[model samples]
Target: MAILTIPVAYLIGAIPFGYLTALWARGVDIRTVGSGNIGATNVGRVLGFRFFVYVFLLDLAKGFLPTYLFPMAVARFTGHAVPQLGVFVALATIMGHNFPIYLKFKGGKGVATSLGALLALNWVASLAAFVGFVLALVVTRFVSFSSMLGGLVFLAVYFGRVDDPWNQEHLAMSVVTIGLFSLLVVRHRKNIVRIKQGTEPKVSFRKKHPSGRVAWVLIPILALVGAGAIYGLAAQANRRSELRLQPYDLTEVERVGTGHQRTERLAYADHGKLLAVTCPRYNRVVLYHVTKAEQLEVARDLELEGKPVAVWTTRDRLYVLVRPSGDERHVKPGWWRAFDLQGEPVGQPVPAGMYPDDLIVTADGRHALVLTSGRGEGDPKRPAPALEVFDLGATPPQVVGRLEFDQPGDDPARIKLSASGNYAAVTLLGSNQIAAVDLANRERPALISRSNLEQSEAPHLTESKDDSILTATTPDRDAVVIPWPKTVATRGGCIACILPQGAGLTLIDAATRRLLGEFPLRAGSLNLGVARPMGLAFSPERGLLAVATRSGSIHLIAVRDRPENIGKHEHVAASEHLGRRR
Candidate 1:
């Protein structure tokens, strides 16, 4: 089905609108007319400007339709859209325009068709090329020269603006751009020679008739004004549609503490009625009661013996992991403390590893999965970064299973379980990898998949910070479940992984382990600016995702389940920052 688009696009482009229009209107072959070319320029020179506009639009539509519509049709049938399909369609359309089979493999120079294809592929690059074409035409009054300049500008802007030139996603498009540029140069070789020899005919705006001359001058001025008005209206409509289509809205941004304190983890419990935020800077676990209006109100703060690193909650219990303060060399074993909903201690602090970062409790509350990054010094027996599974039914929750990472400084940051508690996903900050574990066998959890975020197709995951002070003090990576709502037809859910180095969220399909998409945390008009998003929590009942940033503010984003809004939301690119870590 995808391969058929190329031939269809070629056939559509093969329809020589200029020749058909001339034959139908004046009963003359456009190929035997002025310039001996059946292009819009020749049609206008032989007939009039009106015929030029008609034929140009007809030609443009042929290129635009295939490039824009085929990929969508293919995606609807195949369940996945191949972006490279558009590049093939674009090339086939241009090739057909340049060499129409009906015309004995001879056709126009493909300038107009290429422009139409470019508009469908990348609008920004197309806009830049059009502007260059207009500027060159105004200066030299040579249509051929302007067309060549536009192609060059298109290539320059397309390649120059990409953040990662060698990205696999852009490889096919890059090859297409170079091919199109070469085609333009080869096709316009005769025009180039004529221009160099000073024998090329220049386009003249002046007309012999008085009314014709006046019309020419007024038409351009009015066209510019009309185009500007249309562009303004389109931009306004796009913004309105974006607001309506977006699933989330930033309702409130409540600061956790003094606005300078770093908040690490967040967990919602009691069916989204209670919120727990672990603040390591203040050495306490702050609890918030979620109001009916979706606003957070201070419930209570549980002061701990050590700095609280991570938090989790069950139906009637709150679990907090605390680690000792100061340098890694002097760091001692951390503890996991349990409390009731009212902030009262429920059990004695259980001794954990040297540096326990995050944990998750099973649905039945029979087991607890803890992630510990053993980076502490002065202890040769200090356990390596590992995922420890404990039997919660046993006294003191004894460790029943353990899976230690082979690398020394993997620095596993966060761990989260699937909705059914059958699988787990962990983010390894130090190694720049995300590991998926199969928890179907509770007694023996097994590593199923491991993906390096930096090398993955997910965009903006390569950027990393180098400031050791920030790295040591702040919580950087997190993973939260975007549960599939019962209201929506889709059966499976997605995982939103936050990469602090990139300051964006990478969405992965939980069932297939495929990367769905990546989007920046730029809440444009809502002003919910996120910098180094440290923690995330999702409420299935309310369809809300709470993001806790390092700057000490919690953002509540509502998730929508409307079928129309599933994959239609716009994805904005995140701005790049300098630096990298090993």
Candidate 2:
């Protein structure tokens, strides 16, 4: 019974006070537009005093009635100590109201809900917490800080008064309330910092919406209902699950300066022991012996050719695939030629008249895979629109195989390669499908998964580790690695990316195929490895994962610490075969 109480509390807490309030004000869903918080304050801020009152009252009703009055009803009907359970139920309601699961578990803080619970537990104590918040805000001018302290005060009120009318049997609840309140404070720790620094804005009752109702007549009533509704939901006994997450920091062990664009390309070889980076601005290849963390400018003399598109280095030679521009062809749809590290041409350019935007060289440096049409950033126009597999060692590429999808039906911008050359994952844009191919039989790659594409975006393969399909998700930009490590076989899978909106990264164990956890953005940087985080590179020598943003900052994050959403699954690849002949 006690075990069940926590889930119940979470359910009760999930109610959207601001949402209901918004509806009462405008007869519309608050989340559909504006800042989508469904609290009484937002209603007061957006809808003014008249409707703010309606919303606050409705919210208070949900907050207070569920936790207070409902428990009484149950207690009277059962003729038992139902109020004994009320404490647990009320706590659950507060959690549900703050962080609901049904609506992506996103909700406002629990002040109104807590007020409702306190009213149900003891009106005298509830009044004390309310006054404390108002007074603190008046003095410190920090609403968040006041809320934090007010919550503490509410928990504090139960302690000193054993003779108080409702103080006899609320120990379990007192502890739980304190714990939840602490979590809230921690989550709002940033706000606390702002408050301390005098940067936090005061809670203004001033109206900001032109269509909003009058402010003076609205706010108080909404607060009243917010209290009531929360208690009422508690009375109904709602349940919810809990989530725990830890934050991490991003460290850079090595970095190189370079200009960047959205369609940046990278190639790793020698089991990712060698990371080769090519930038249009640098117009050359930068090689790093990842393990030693040593970097070298192996070749910068490709002046006659286009910027480095894809690079691979064998033990004795280097092969680079370039899509030449400022010519008859556009940047992404231009000529793709191969050159040795000595700046010597290896083979005929892949296409006689067209350039390739993307490339993947074979493990032995014997072949080069090219993707055109899906070229040049995310323009969606001027798509080179074809696949060309070239023999890297050939004077001009020896066409090994090719595939082309109809326009609008397939926008193949994202691609991946397995170490065994057994599969290729393609993100078919303008649609939904994680295109899987059988690379084992080079002439014809078969589709293994097409219907279940969550989002086949920013795809990568653990080329060094052998067999994992790694893809970046849209919306959240999470790196997901699905492995078929048992043997070198092409496996079929569905399409998917980040999900449930606003949820953190979901880690899946390749072997068990179970979701490990929702990994948070552990790195301290405001953002990286996500949202058009166009570049990721793992340097085995440095034990670092390079995360790059379009704005031109590269972060070398340590992979060992298990950063929240940083590293990709298919860590590195071999490029001896993709380079010039020894």
Clashes of each: 0, 93
Superposition TM-score, candidate 1 onto the true structure: 0.47
Report the lDDT tens digits of candidate 1 across residue range 1-582: 999989988988888988899999999998886877778888988898899889888788787889999998999998777757998998899888889998987899888888898899988788889998987786567999999999998886676444233434456788889888998999888989999999998777775424447657867886897599667645532331111222232223233331324566888989988888877766777788888877788898777788887788999999888887755424578878889998999868887787887777888999888888775222456777789898888877788888877654477776756656777767777676777788888878898878775533332121113210011112454566565544442343555667544655555544445555554443222222334567778888777677776545566666655544444322111101000110
lDDT score, candidate 2, position 39: 66
C-alpha lDDT values of all predictions: 0.70, 0.53
lDDT of residue 242 for candidate 2 = 19
* TM-score for each candidate, following the candidate numbering: 0.47, 0.41
Model 1: which residue pairs collide? none
Clash number for candidate 2 = 93
Q: What is the per-residue lDDT of model 2 for residues 193-230, given as tens digits with 9 covering 90 to 100?
A: 87678776666644563333544455666578769955
lDDT against true structure, model 2: 0.53
In candidate 1 the C-alpha lDDT for residue 408 amounts to 46
